[model samples]
Target: MAQETDAPQAPPSAPTAPARALLPLILPAVVVGVTASLVFVGVSVAAERLQQVLWGPLPDALGVGRYSVLWMFAMLTATGLAVGLVVWKAPGHAGADPATFGLNSPVMAPAVVPGLVLATGLMLAGGPSLGPENPVIAVNVGLAAWLGARLLPRTPGALWPVLAESATIGALFGTPVAAALVISEALAGRPMRGRLWDNVFAPLAAGACGAMTTTLVAHPAFDLGLPPMSHHPHAKDLLTALVISSAAALLGMGAVHAFPYVHAAFRRLRHPMLMIPAGGVVLGALGALGGRLTLFKGLSEVGELARRPEGWSAGQFAAMAVVKLTALLVAASCGFRGGRIFPAVFIGTAVGLCAHALVPAVHPAVGVATGVLGMLLAITRQAWVSLFTAAVLVASPSVLALLCIASLPAWLLVTGRAQMQLREDGTPVR
Candidate 1:
């Protein structure tokens, strides 16, 4: 990776810093900047290749349990290897784990950005089941810091780091709104205090970056998946929306709360590095037990669940929900580095299915639409983003309509409760 300095985007005339100050910042910036772009891109490409590796004909020679034991082993080995590489060569690679990034209190060594990106990509390509979101944010901050430091080449502060981080987050994640909120929360830099100016520009920069990234990445073929989640107003629909959103809010909260503890417990393994592969064993077992109903068909499961017939009973869907949720949590904790996006979709789909059972007359898709609307809003803590994510998942205006209505209440409920519990995750809405 050809890394430049920490100069974010300097004007033609910026004063030179003392040689002493400039030297330290440049190396880290170059290493971090180029390394991050390389590793993250590698992971994205590797994700496509991983499918072939898992189900290829050679699996028979490897073993019968390719998707089960072998896959898990591969994931674990990959994660361990990545950790080993970083530990041996780039000691500062794993400074901020997932939760730390989520909370925005990251120890970003922008100087070591390349090492961090490589480490993160290695972890993800191996299948730790964590989201791409964390890596993206890490790179965002790392690059931001590197750029800021290089440009000024003098007295450097965290202001550019914060803006660059936020903006990059916005551009890359396609969730600029969330990136903005994250920056605003992090500005306090303390436990809980808000700075006025930091609050304003953080989102602006992040959102702008996010918008730009989305535009660049999406382009003309921005298929964005499904149609928007909208619905016609109705009294009955409104009633169902309330119940579904409230339940989803509670479930979302419960899930987030249990996650840290769940992660801390089982992941405490004898071979600390092999935790993910060990987790793969558990995940494979769960999938096998759940049957094809909860297998790693990727987002295929989402499509099937969405098209579920009307009057789908809760009993049939319950096991699927438990299995999928367990798989997601374990896969993540065990180190299958993927996004929570699809898992959230599954959770919302099940919630919709169950809620639909309560109102059998309504389409299952409609119920699912509503459930997803709530689920997305609950976790993201951003309604527009939630609405947009859910809307892009299906092929019907009806579902989109229901999503808009359902998401409104869901956002209000989730965002309110999150205001309290999320202080631990780094967002304290003042």
Candidate 2:
């Protein structure tokens, strides 16, 4: 992917800094990385435990199927109300409306961290079709920045957000490479004093530590367990990849365009309490229509879908894709605190399965990887992250060439278009 030329380029004669100045940062980076990963794991585990009680024992005790449409509706509605209460009464209004932020948003106030974490936990446990990435990143960044400034007063204030952001990303993806790619794209077109590696050194160390910590604690895995594509890429595979990825991009763009309007509609409600419960009702209807498979952030559901692709027909997969996309749109538009990336991956997985079901000749791995590449590119508008994520999900080097080629048209479709994020006034973030 080509870097954006929106900022001035660095001079060729930019001087390199000595090792002494750079090496001192490594210790702080490691500390930040490990701390960030622990926070990520802590929040996720708490959410998981809450989910078990809400969906498991409570439903069973009531003699109702946990996935029954009515139960799903009630849980979602209740979750919304609970989150609304927190936002209304808790500090920082859950760290600004989630609709107004993106993956790499500004550092939040320390007081906002508790509310944000609480709201995020509710959304995750309540099956909001969103991921932990956004709020968790906010929490980590806020904490890191505040603490770093006080404890290391001599260090640059800007450094904490960078290290914390990289560390959180590394923890989220379970790889420092993801942090490197995301940060690299974020740094595109900006002029800096040192070489690229010099700028990235501390962040890279933080990312490495974060990824290692998550690996040791959570044992996260990105691969969907799909059968590998053993054959070398041919001309037909390239064409297939292009078509699938382009189609997926178009689908994701539909959601992006709809974001502002959806957000505006919810805004008319005039309060988080009203807006959120109403959103919950709509999400319940969607869950009822799409079934249990379409709820939550979608990582585990996508894995289930991958494990038995033949169990569902093309129509089913297509329905799942649409339902999940709509759920994402609704959840995000109605003030839910979470990220779109994980649910987008689920949509991509469903789209890929649908493609394979319709055309048996298309390899599942190729379809999945390209589908993810397109969706992530369109949704996140971060090329390196999109490419890295799609590549990792399949764990196939052979698919990398196809993803690279397919991303071109997909990127073009979304490049200058409105993003999934909204401005403070509910306009698309461009």
Candidate 3:
């Protein structure tokens, strides 16, 4: 079925040594990092202001009491409609669908940036259960790639995507190390002419700069204010972590299994205008049932759950976890532009808190970490990144060993299982 070429084939260009390729990228990498951080800060600021308007003054003006379930429903519906409009009208189809793409998808064309930003801003302000990680990464990568082409035109084309993704990850997590782990894991087992670290050098520089800049500007906080595990770990703690982490992985897998069916259902609706607002209605109902704490991407909400585990009963925590998971499924499946990782983390926190409540002997910090590790492993299917996130977020250096031990059981549970990502054909792609 293939046609043969009649003309002579062009010879491949000579490869540049890794060191020579990286040398000119040093300054350009820094500039890209700074740009990505500033862009993220701007988006965050805008979303915060929108949140205030929707949750604060708008409610007062409308005379709806704070925390009114009806207001939550209305706002989410409006948000869905707003996003539907953007998706309907945006250039380049507003880039790739999040369901069909990974964190490191090719950079989108520059024309799609406006629609992407607006849809993401609306989703965040409207209190979708998804987070800014996916959309923001796309935005930064597209912009960074475009800029890098102009300023460093001679840089290897492959390196531009790496720089953009590195900067975005660093900005998102506020850590160069997170970017390093992610990139290293992504590149593992791939055939390369040079050492893996050699290719990573430029991206790492960009990531470090991005992390520093975002920290200085946004002060993005990941630590949950739980009491540290100051005492030495007991054998019982290891047992507790294994049980909790495995259980959490199983819980996360339940959502993963349901993902393809739910995504198909949404796609069956066949139009963004019909599908997105309907999804929003469902999210609003879930919020009404689960309360304000269950709304939004679970960044601050997860921390709140950890900080005040005593405030919720086991049944209440269970409800929050389930509702949050359902919301994530609906938002991601029904054309929302965001990442599932943050909401999954929130669900894990709720599950862990519930486990701790049931068995009072386990330390809350350990419970939370194991739960995070398991859920992240199941959802992302990346062990190193999950392990790093579990250890880093707790901010307790002493528990790293315990978390490392905890992750093995979770990995066993999740290995060769379903993944959360979908293929271009609208089916889950594990």
**Lowest lDDT 10-mer window, candidate 1?**
219-228
Q: 34-124, model 3: which lDDT tens digit per residue?
A: 8888887888789989998989999999899657988988988889888888998899767777888767766889999999999888898
RMSD to the hidden true structure, all candidates:
11.3, 5.1, 7.3
Model 3: lDDT equals 0.85
Which of candidates 1 and 3 reaches a greater lDDT? 3
- Writing each residue's lDDT as its tens digit, candidate 2 over 1-430 gives 9787778887677678899989899998999999999999999999999999999999999999999988999898898899888888888899888888777868889999999999999999999899999999999999999999999999999999999999999999999998987887777767776777888989999999999999999999999889998899999889999999999999999999998999999999999999988898899899999999999999999999999989999999999999999999999999888999999999998898899999998899999999988998888898888888899989888999999999999999999889998887777888
Report the number of the highest-lDDT candidate. 2
The TM-score measured for candidate 2 stands at 0.97
Question: What do the candidate models score in CA lDDT, each in turn?
Answer: 0.54, 0.91, 0.85
Model 1, residue 254: what's the lDDT?
A: 63
Q: Can you write out model 1's per-residue Cα lDDT over 216-334, one digit (the tens) per residue?
A: 55431212243233556467766776677667666765666566665665446634355545665665566556654464423555666555544346876666766676766675454
Clashing pairs in 3: none
For each of the candidates, give the backbone clash count.
34, 0, 0
Off by over 4 Å in 3: 1-21
Best of the candidates, TM-score: 2
Better structure of 1 and 3 per TM-score? 3
